[model samples]
Target: MRRVLAELALGVRLAFAGGRRGWLRTAMATLGVGIGAAGLLLAASVPTMLDGRQARTDARYDSPGGVTVPAGRTTILAGPDGQSGDNAIRARLLWPEAPGAPLPPGVPAFPGDHQMYVSPALRAALDGPDGDTLRRQMPYEIVGTIAPAGLSGPHEYAYYAGYQRATALVEQQVAWRVDRFGYPSLDVEAGAGGTYVIVAVLVATLLLPVAIFIGAALRFGGDSRDRRLAAIRLIGADSRAVLRMAIGESLVPAGLGLLLGLLFYLLIRGQVERFWLFDVSVYSADVRPVPSLAVLAVAVILGLSAGVTLLGFRGVTVEPLGVLRQAPTWRGRLWWRLIAPAASLLLLYPVLLGRENVGEARTGIGAVLLIVALIPLLPYVVPVVARLLPDGTASWQLASQQLRRNPSSSTRAVSGIVVAVAGAIALQSLFGAAEVERSIPYDKADPAFLLQARDRTSTDAMKQRSARFEQVSGVRAGTVALYTIYQKDIIGLANLYIGDCRSLSQLATLTGGCEPGDTFTAGSAEKVITIDKGEINPAPGVRLAVPAKARKATLIGSNAQGVASAVLMTTIPAQLARVEPGFVETRMFTDEKPAVVAGKLRGVAAEIDPLAMFTAMAPEGDRFGPLRVALNVGSTLILLMMAVGLLLDVAARLHERRRILGVLAAVGARDGTVIWSVLLQVIVPVAAGLSLAVGAGTGIGALLMRLSQVPVIFTAGTVLLPVAAGAGLVLITTVAVLLPAVRRVTRTEELRYE
Candidate 1:
């Protein structure tokens, strides 16, 4: 144990010595690990934070198990449909007989009868300065406020009234049904299946590039450390001692980085809480990692750093001579690069082509595999591409030779670039797919004006409004359809539309032909009417006889709507036909703007909904706006990370190549030649990786769209933008990182080193 302690002490001393001598390198390495650790901690905290919020919400809604029903059942409020009315408030009555579960923190207990508690947002809306303008159906006394968690969405306006009044209201109304019965023990689990899978994929996509960046950073200063460790082995240290020393060296930076990461998380936790997850902001206290999880994360990061350090020594022998003689000539098996991608394609084709029954999990796995396949090909392809570069100048030749000599290192430097390019392509393809607009093809012209009433108005009143609308200039035709909510003896919730056959035919295409005087009934049920009206049986299709010049016609409900649905159209007199209280839709075909036509009819109608009309209209595609924005932001960030990685790698390489460059300077090589060589060294591999990434990314994106059953539409902009941006970034970054290094190496002082 004492011997182990001595060795550990020596290792720590060596680490401190290295840090003191090369503080900049140590700082850069520590910064990279710290950023990665912070990112991982933040990523891991998302699920935890969201889960905590969900639990709190469930506790608020379900803790006091009660019988809950809509407030409309007990009250005869105007426009009780909960839509398009000033009095339309979505209130729930909860009767808490016995406490089932404990209420969530910050939520008060249920209020007494006639006393109500409203959501905070609702309270703001009702008690705001303009609250008086918004009329309520009933004046209920507000006693308390419900926290945001008590409601489903931030914008939801809801009221929770006492149980006794709620029961009495339901009994009196005899219309509204109880929506939910919450028990104390009932756990309301959020819906999960495809949504969770998509979330997992999104999270994975976000972290993969960061992971690659961090791994590449860990390899920083690796060549220098290997040589130093080899000297220690020559002085009688065994392989175990060498391994222990390497682990200790890595852990020093990793431990400090972990602590720094934790501090970063603490600093940013408040900002994180301000952001919404699952449509609600989580409590600040809930957005923290549990003690055990925090410990585990630190342990894992430390262990990973140790493991990576160990892997760097994979092929290196402990013997000093063997390590010193090692060179970059060892090449990976080039042929093996093809296997992973080919196998992934083989597995993916069946699913993409629909030959296999696959779920979201399989599709996500296939996508992951496709992206992973591109990584292995980099080392093999980069060198081959370098060999193909035209040998225009001595600098180009030198750059190409350098790339061919150290393809693995070059590949690692540009791996993030490849991944970022691929992600951009995939995201753009998804955007194109989602932008496809779906519509039912209609051969007839659309109605120029469709004016819907606030509530069910009389047929006489609708006729008067339609007549007034038609009187306006450029109004060639107009018609009114009175719609009612009719409970069919068997069919439930049927929207009954009553209108003249001739006028209705002009507005919409009828399945059964309609003439000026013909009265016809068309619907799903076979029998138009049944004798036992009290018995609720499924409505069957009915073929009603056409009444010659009939004054009235009544048709039962149908399963289909629009042109296909069973509608009763007749020459019914406005005064005789029953006009149930519902929406009165006035359709008009006119050259005037809908707003103008609406203005003309407003005098005859009780209300007019706002309408702003423009002269010309262009159809826009149904683009995935939010997804596009997210992808654009995410891909741009990843690309930026890749740019930084390129810069770091170039800086590291410049240090490694200084002595060789100094020798070249001593030989009288031109400064311009060396500058070009430096640029080519960075740009050549990047160009190759990017080209391959575009092709592979496009293919993977197409396959993913196929797997998701979404159509792939390749636009020129989507293809060109990523390519141009990637190339531009490469050129800019290469010049930025290597220009000064090239100038420094070409200096006379550098030559003196040789």
Candidate 2:
């Protein structure tokens, strides 16, 4: 035990003993592992962050999804919260029943008379240069800011305004009496299936590659390291001692890198308020890493680093004279590499084909397996591609030969890039396929406008509502549909249908169109209700000059107004125009973008009808707006990460070969040949690897789409986009690493060890 400890301590001393090269390897390992650590930590924090945000929100409301309380001294009248659609302001009116009524969290006291309390984000917006429009809408006296405890995030927009007439608002049904705020805490998933899958797969995509690179970094300066180990072997230490020393060397950097990553994650949390994505913001305190996941991440990174370093010494013999490395052979390792992908497909086939309920987490597991499975295929793939390259020149022969070797070091270094790109393509395909399923073919256009109201029997108010509806943008015209009752039946216009020639024509067909104030009896109204064809008294003190003979017009097949039966009176007689309506509707015929128009009209209608039953006759499927945004951002970030990892891996490999290239140059080899050889070494293998990546990604996406019960939406663009991106990555990595590789190869000192 003591001897083993002595050797381990000796390895640590030797890690930093070899000047700049040793320290550079350590630094690179730290950075590589650090990146992976940070990614894992951030992914782990997502669930916790969302829960904390929900908790804060629930705590602030006193009762989440509110309940009405009995009017009492300690009760407050509150309600009618604003929606997120317009300016995202959560505007609410609060009227305290007594001075001792409990207040919301984060609020020290109620605002002064005629004053409103706003969130910090809201205050900032209102005070900014472009707050004029909002100010006009909310022209209340601003007394102070609502503290953080009352908000979901720093960017949330909310305001609590004092209402003087709480009783009147309660009576109007706009506000309700509540003894307290908020409800019990609800534990929410960061996102349900789509969201969770997106986040998880994205995190895995980025992290797996980083893990590969960390292993590569840990084994860097290999030639220098072997020579040092050879010296130890000469001094009577056995292979076990050498291996322990190697583990020690790798452990220090692995440990440091993981620790650095944890520190970086904490720093990110400290400034969490400054960050926002997918239209979401979180508080600093809410961003916390799950301890179990964090620990696992550290363990994984450290284990991988040490393991890869240990593997580097495989099949090498250290003698007293020099270190003898057995030739790197990967000739017959194909079968094992195929097992992972085969298993991955098996796991997913049940879900996609049989429609089995294996659960979302299991599918996520399948996706992750499929994404990294390509790494195992790299060795088999590279040789096949290299054989296709023309070996007409010295550089071509050299590159082709290097690829044919498929040394373990080369394989590990390139694995990160391959996995990253494969994962990206898979993610894109999944989204596109899901999109095809979500956005079904356009349904037959159902009416977008249908407003309902109750016992609103005032002619002037109904007319005014119609006029306001016309004011809504895109509304071509507006008309009032008065649904009168007969025999207490609540079906469509049972008693009367009165409108002018132009307005009533939209509801039903009229032969040659009649004059203004026309009247018609159709549906049940025709059979039961009787109308005199003269000046008749429909109600006391309300007399209408009825038509001598009413025309029976045909109701239109379908319309924006979702009514089964209509009076089809294209024109109401001019004399009966003043008849009051029993129940009213300001129906709208809006242009394209009916949703926007409908939303604006809803706000407008709220002035007259506190509870507006705004319903779209036909439902519109979700467009995956947030999913698209997340994919765009995630793709961009992962691509950048892929590029960096590829660059570093290629860099380390180049540095490892500096001695050989320097010796070749010393023997009169041309610099151009060396540079081209290195470039070809990467390009040819990557070209083949990327093709496999695309195939694998598409397959994974197809399975996910099937599991989601959506049609596969494969397009030329989906396949071609990842190809273009891979091509670009190769181009960028080539430009980034070439000059330095050439400089190192031509350096006189690079051949010192040789």
Candidate 3:
């Protein structure tokens, strides 16, 4: 114990000395780790929080009496190819039956006869020249149920109404109020769910890898102190004592770092939480870490592990006599070539085979595999490439030869570069691919004018304008469809005006190029109107037994993501003839650019605005805001670290080979030659490393494309731009770190041993 304590004291002193000497480098490394840890924590925390909240919300729906929805409203979504010519469907608010029970689907059941529910079929025949059911034998699924007198009332005589009546209520609600235009809303009642373990797991996952990285960086200082360790060894301190000292060295600082990291995490937690895109408020209240107690313990263990491991390694392989005789050339097993390639291949194969559900696992596997393959191979490759450079001017030649002779030094030099290049290339690839997929084709379909109305006053004017506009332009007259929103009652429904039956055939082509006069056939007197996926009553592809007298309709199509907007595509005359006294009209289709007619529509309130309302589109120039900042900051720090590592290796080599470089200086080699040789050596290996990084980045993007629902395209700018930036960063970092060291060597006196 006494011996161990003494070693601990010595280690603590040495660790401080190292920190004091290398404060800048140490701080930079710590910052790098902190940022990475924070980012990871934030990412993990968001998804965890969202999933946790969703789970709790889902549990609330499993309560005793079951959930309650609006009364008389059945069928969650309209089916594709369903009955048309009736009124439109609207979204409704849900009310739960019991604490845990889900809200049933239907019209809101207020206890009173003051509200009237009417079928949409009542006005269908009056509105158009045709009306019919597309199908006759379709069953209805209950979407929502209503209980009278709220949850407190006793059972009373209750009546159920048809979809037509329900739709009428929905229309009234929208027509009487403006709330129908509000963004969709979702509310949940959470029960006594357990503490959020998901948050803990997420935060831990984010921090753990960072902790491991910190541990690794901490190991570097521990390794550097081995020379001092040998001194103690020579002074009759046993190998175990030296090991203890190393352990003590790493633990003390790592403990400090752990403390700092935790504090940083806490300090930024609030800001981080807001931007997390997930709700983790539950975790913030639940998870409370003990004041550095766990961190201290972990630090101590890591220190001991690192110290003992390195001590054991030295005991087995490092000879004191060899150290005393001359500085040792860095040694590594050459078999890493075989091991790295094989392991990399193995790691990559799984990623290729991984399914969508296992995506995160595949990413983890790929990252691990790449690290394993890259780190070991870098040392060997760096040296061979360095050696192959032309041996010229004295400084360059000295730098090159010095690098060639020191494998450990080269490894350090390239570490930061590898990390920086990898990140830059990766981000470049991802964003580039995303951009390609997102940019809409320039010649997209446009709406000439959209007319919005609060009631029937604008329908006739809209119909007249539709005809006059087509006649004046000498183009085929476009169909005039009516759209309305009713909000005068307890329920709300959006209505569409389905125009000429022929326009129905062009529905699929609306998103692209189509012949204008395709015909859509409806059975009997009803015109078959195909609704946009979002505008459909029920979900697409299901049959709906709408109350259209004897006719039935089936849902034929649907948009995958929800409604962009509600649309009605029917004849103007048909729509006008059936207009309700109170309804809103809106139009959204045209071939003419609204910008050209902006002056013409300035005085017209009913003129449809040509600009599509995009709720989430970013403005110009800021498209790369957060992503660019993150990518650049992360890349800069890592690449800079890598550059520093290289310089450190070069410095160490220069220090060890002072005699060799001095002899070369005496041999008449020019300073320029020396400089070139050194730069060339660095340039060669780095180039190879860069190539590998670029290749890996390209491959990762391709893999993402294969795995994602959206296509991930590879563009020249995405691939090349980041690579160029990486190369530039390498040049800058190398020059910044090495110039002083290089200059000092050139000016310093050559050593002579006679």
For candidate 1, the C-alpha RMSD (Å) to the true structure equals 7.8
Q: Is candidate 1 or candidate 3 better by TM-score?
A: 1
Output the TM-score of candidate 1.
Answer: 0.73
Tens-place lDDT per residue, model 2, 1-754, is 9999988898888778667766776887788778778877887888888888777788865443445567675444444423322234566667678868868777778775457888887788778874653454355799888888888888888888776655675664555766676756454435434454555566666677776767667766665577577667767778898888887877788788878898888887788887554446788888787889778877777778766765656533424343434244556478898888887777777666766656677677777878778887876878876776566888989888877875454455556666767766767777676555432222333245666654434445545667777876667444554533332344443345554555566566676557755666444334334332222223232223434466666665344244434454434434345544443655566665553454455566556553444444322223345555656665666566556656666776677678778887888889898888888887776777787778877876676566545566778777778778867886678668887668766776887863
Angstrom error at residue 17, model 2:
5.5
Better of 1 and 3 by lDDT: 1
Question: Per the 3 Å backbone cut-off, how many clashing residue pairs does candidate 3 have?
Answer: 88
Best by lDDT: 2
Best by TM-score: 2
**Of 1 and 2, the candidate ranking higher by TM-score:** 2
In candidate 2 the C-alpha lDDT for residue 408 amounts to 53
Stronger candidate by lDDT (1 vs 2) = 2
lDDT values for all models: 0.57, 0.65, 0.42
lDDT of 2 at 606: 52
The order by descending TM-score is 2, 1, 3
**Candidate 1: tens digits of C-alpha lDDT, residues 475-578:** 64444454332234435333335566545655444654666445444344222322121212433332233234433323312113232223344444343244
TM-score of each model, paired residue for residue: 0.73, 0.76, 0.60
* lDDT by residue for model 3 (49-82), tens: 4554444334322222223334332322111111
Clashes of 2: 15
